[model samples]
Target: MHDGAVDLKAEARARIYAQPIEMLDPAQPELFATDAMWPIFERLRAEDPVHWVEAPDYGGYWSITGWNDIMAVDSNHQTFSSADGITLQSLESKAETARRGARPSFISMDPPRHDEQRKTVSPVVAPSNLTVMAPVIRERAGQILDGLPIGEEFDWVEHVSKELTAMTLATLFDFPQEERRLLPHWSDMITNAPGHGPVESWEHKRREIDAMVARFTQMWNDRVNAPPAGDLISMLAHGESTRNMDKAEYAGNLGLLIIGGNDTTRNTISGSVYALNKNPGQYRRLREDPSLIPSMVSETIRWQTPLAHMARTATADCELGGKTIKAGDRVVMWYVSGNRDASMVEDPDSYLIERARPRQHMSFGFGIHRCVGNRLAELQLTIIWEEIMKRFPSIDLVAEPDRTHSIFVKGYESLPVMIPSRN
Candidate 1:
């Protein structure tokens, strides 16, 4: 690490530790943007793995940082219910959401309903479909990479990461590929809050949602009227469990799918480049053995846990980590923190693409809500890297990334990069 970066991390640690433990609210979005959340998670994991926060805005929420504890909370969905909604939304935001369009995605539902609803869209990413999609991803990735101007600075996130994911996302919904840019924008609107990031205000966000609803609802109507097809919209339109869904439910599902299909993979694509830039040794090793693409993909997902946290409401009074979590209390399992737990992962902070057990991380949650599109995300990363290896020997990170300002979506907004020459 550079002397300045090391000093900044040390400063952040001191400042974070100087504050009282009880006052810590892990949901703060600003910390993630400035990349200061790492030290905060470091402190939380060390002192109070199962910590509590009683913020006026957030009310009371539990932050689970340890790997095993997070796994327990994630797997036992019955006790830690997702029905209240995920990602630690504030009371005001929750109320606003209900009034705005009631985006009640299946990911937030429990049991039979969640399973049935999720089942409708699972086929899009099935092994057979992923096989079909792999070559398409490679072709698009190659085209995107080829289009980049050599020896000139450009935002990698815009040119490659976002471009590839947006196309894939558009295909999954059978939406117009030309309008693929809207997919990531809608995903941003889903997680954005007034003043925190992309969203300017609740009204501004509501307007964005309105545009999304109009577009998605039109697609839903078109797909529902047509014969059953292979895309996600058609699957939901034809599936018994989803066909009768209400408007709000449909909007919710669309938002979830868009965000799910975009964020994790896009962020990780950008993160992979940044990680390799920082850990040049790993990049050198990878360039020599292109066979290590899969391992590198898994390691990048682990290193850049795109989703920071998923919030669950306790269904009943439960004992976790020797603490009593009352029924109805908000509990947030920090995937980002668990992915960095040294107890489970050796040298967790270090970015090692060739780790022995690279996929042993919580970037994709466990149990019923485990990411359905995980394999597709991996496939995209693997194919992109494979295609990239066949082109450029290295991508120069011109500057640090412009990260997203949300504790929910740990991602990049822009990553400036330059390729000096193609191999």
Candidate 2:
């Protein structure tokens, strides 16, 4: 049956012969924030942790919510495969795989290939590399905060967080700063779900992807022929394992790098500002003690869960949390829900900046697929928060923030704020 005519609930039941499941209706985005499905998650964690969600509009799949179940799916690459794609629904799975093709990045690979490609860049993203980047990131953060106009309302998403993250990513890739803004736009075009952002048509999205691939193609040739000193592009271009990467693999890896490096970091920054604005006490506490920036940043990521759920297609028949899953069934690990898991996290509601388990969040994911750029993201966050506190001492939300309408990435699209001039 076609998408519109299919019964998602029945389809879900057929896929996993466990407790009957309810598909999350995309129509209600607030369900994510209102803790609507939370009680169900808590119930399942106590009972059937691997619950199936058969939702309409998007194709149906199983929703794995508990921390253990999420990790099981994340770590067991042999049983659960990322090669199918890493988001909800079979449509997205198929489209992404097809679009990615032989050019699949480490995000879409399993085992040996994943490990090799992941290793090539892991050192650059390690804590040591982040330490090197911290001051550079801090300097940029200060520059962005310094450039903000005093007492005037502006789009924080565009100006402060997005700009900073984009610039940093550009610097890492050695892309011209003026030209790097297109990276975010290209990422959105490739991944933005239906009914969100500027990716209005499939044809348009495909064309955009082709254009982005073409740009990367040229860059790849340039880097391959005349390698730079030590940028990411140069590393990819010259690395022994990555040098002979085919065209599709090269382009896909490049696209994955852009999205993985930019989106979560940018969104978390925007979300942190909104969170702090809503919780004045937490904001005050953070500003008063700039040392709390790291914990505060982790709290922001846990609170935002920016990367949302990542999908894994079952490679072998398996049973999980009392549910039987057939081979090839899509298993979506809901990081957003998992991050808020009450059993693993304390309270799970209050945005306390001093939460002791600061890095315990799943926003960067877990196990092998854990974010490679996590330290860089955190370093950038710390830098930004420190600069904001030092330069302005105080900031306030001027209006209700706007959120992007995508289930895969949770973040604000627009946030207006007022930063008083310290001068």
Candidate 3:
């Protein structure tokens, strides 16, 4: 099945490369799912940095493929408003979201309001907070690594990546430890396309979301009734700005926190294993010098490019990358493409753990809307690698991973691996 997918991707790449620049459309989700979007992005970055793609399902949208161009769009929040939405999904899906009463979080709001709401939970992941949590994270990482089956094949995504991230997320929210798995589940349901993975239909997704909102709402009520605490729920409940949010807005904020806490770091954890296995030299270097763990973590994030793209609507006519974008145009900054741009990154396709500037990638975005939980993500990855080095001699991938079928979240569904026991 994997070979067949690769063959199809090769055929698609040939056809795409042969086509005229005016005819290319890179918005298709299959390209990302099958890991075949590299050639398409390479072509766009070289030929049309600011490419306009017209898809049958998603209509016309601008693809910002270059690193500098993406930075420009990401930084200029005033000109490209995130309020219109941030994915290249069909307009109908946007309408359906509104119909289902999906509220807009601060991520989707512009300046003033965005800043106001974001401040509520910003301190939870602050440098001071992360400093205090590092030892705790390392301890948990040690516990998780110690429990892995030795010389036995297991799903790394479930036993390691998801478990560690879910635990940290539970800690961040002060959520019930046993119910921590539900956080990632809610995130999956929120981002998965209909008929993909766990989502069977739009109705099923809606029902799942409704249940998630109700659960969180109950937590919110409980938190609000108690004395203030540092968990996310308590922060929002007692926050001067967030305490009065309506139901939809509350749900929207919850979704943001869940996805922010779950998807990015979890995928990077899985990606680190896959990347190291694929780049044996780097893995050897890592084993020889475990101090390179921080660099390895950053490089893995760049290599994975967890969240593929972020869409923005042009608030005014703007000229970028030699293209004139009109008002209200949907401009998508493909971070996956930018992270791989040869012009910006040295040997961008290769995963090197000792890069001079490992943290120079755009995975966490830029400017004011940059990820709030980025430090925590990095800390978690660093701690996990440290613990893994202390325990296992090596972890071998048993087979190709089952990747999630979505362009938005570039993630693995399952990664089979066997850990070699230490002597």
Candidate 4:
């Protein structure tokens, strides 16, 4: 662990037992970045599952730490609106985004409008579509694994995780394959805070987004002019509801699709390698029985919880888990914490690939807002692991992964690993 992580752990340790449970703040980004958040969540789940904390940066928010509580909040979309936002952005940042005229996406909308817009892109990842995509995904996964440098250290996040996801995302949008790298780049800029990770400033983020809109606008125009097709752009251009969307709405949906398509699966791919290495017994079981790939993929998603928390605004005063939330209060459902709630998941902390009900996870939000691309994410992960088992005896992690510096995206920036050459 880095010195920063050590300090955060020390701080958490000092606070976990010493401070009042109501005062403990689990939304601190450093805790997530260092992977030292488990203990904090564990403490919250035990002592105060519906904990409240005030922060100078993001203001006061309620942390719903338990699995059932999170499910309640996620499922009760009418009472907890996602329109104000689905993240813990600072009040200042929220005001600034509004000042700059932020657009609305289905993820941040409610009721009739959200449903109508979501249906536009739902078919892209439908079961029938995934069946058609399966072979293409497998072929890409094979090529990516075969191209890895055996017996040499390399960044797995870069070579395999990002590359494969980018390829799939490009195919989804029918985006230019040559420009596929931009998909992840835009996703990073959209999610990362300024002065952390790739984003240097909010201005830089704006410029990159402007470029993205320009590119997508051209695609939108072209697709609208042409006959209806199966790609995401074509779906949006020709779909009854989305066809008349304004620029802001179009850009909003594009950002949603890009991040949804890129980050969650990309991080899970990296996490699977790290998780398997950390649990060698599980790795051995996996190697011994490759049929466990599907279950293992679900387990990895639960263990990783790629997207940590989704914020919701209380539509009206309500009581939850013994705490009262007032109207307009920010209620954050910590999926990262919920996924590990021992009350719900058996031995939740351990990376047991062969769990009886591996698919019962909260990584994908529950109810109507559950991830539409979840099946596609699972497909990518399953294919990659199957391909990995076929080629390499083992992949050894050379160093600790460089994790992302955001609480929202539980992901690795890089994971150094080496694959031994076959004799």
| Backbone atom clashes (below 3 Å) for every candidate | 0, 5, 0, 0
Lowest summed lDDT across 10 adjacent residues in model 2 is found at 26-35
Q: What is the lDDT of residue 195 in candidate 4?
A: 80
Worst 10 residues of 1 by lDDT: 1-10
lDDT of 2 at 316: 84
The TM-score measured for candidate 3 stands at 0.97
What is the number of residue pairs that collide in model 2?
A: 5
Report the lDDT tens digits of candidate 4 across residue range 1-87: 458767877886866778677668877778777777777788899989998899767899998999999999999999999998788
lDDT by residue for model 1 (348-415), tens:
99999778899999999999999999999999999999989999988989988888988788999999
Instruction: Say which candidate scores most in lDDT.
Output: 4
Model 2 Cα lDDT, one tens digit per residue, 1-423: 234323543454344334443533332344433323344555555555676656664565777878878988888888999987676643553565576454568788887888888887676676777777778888888888878888888999888877888888888887889987887888788667545677876667778888988887777788889944467777888887788888778877887888888888999999898889879999888867888998999999898888778989998899988789989898888887788788788888678899979778788877788888887888788888877777786777887666676667677778888877683
TM-scores for all candidates: the values are: 0.97, 0.88, 0.97, 0.97
- True-vs-predicted CA distance for residue 317, candidate 3, Å: 0.9
Q: What's the lDDT for residue 37 in model 1? A: 83
Cα lDDT tens digits for candidate 3, 1-423: 367877887898898899999777777778777777788888999999899978787889999999999999999999999997677877667768777765789899998889988999999998999998999889888888888888889999999999999999999999999999998899999989887878888899999999999998999999999999999999999999889999989988888999999999999999999999988898999999999999999999999999999999999998998789999999999999999998889999999999999999999999888988889999999999988998887899888888888878999999999987863
Q: After TM-score superposition, what is the CA distance of residue 31 in candidate 2 from its true location, in Å?
A: 5.0
What candidate 3 gets wrong by more than 4 Å, as runs, is 1-6
lDDT of 1 at 327: 95
Q: Residue 227, candidate 3: how far off, in angstroms?
A: 1.8
lDDT (Cα, 0-100) at 19 in candidate 1: 96
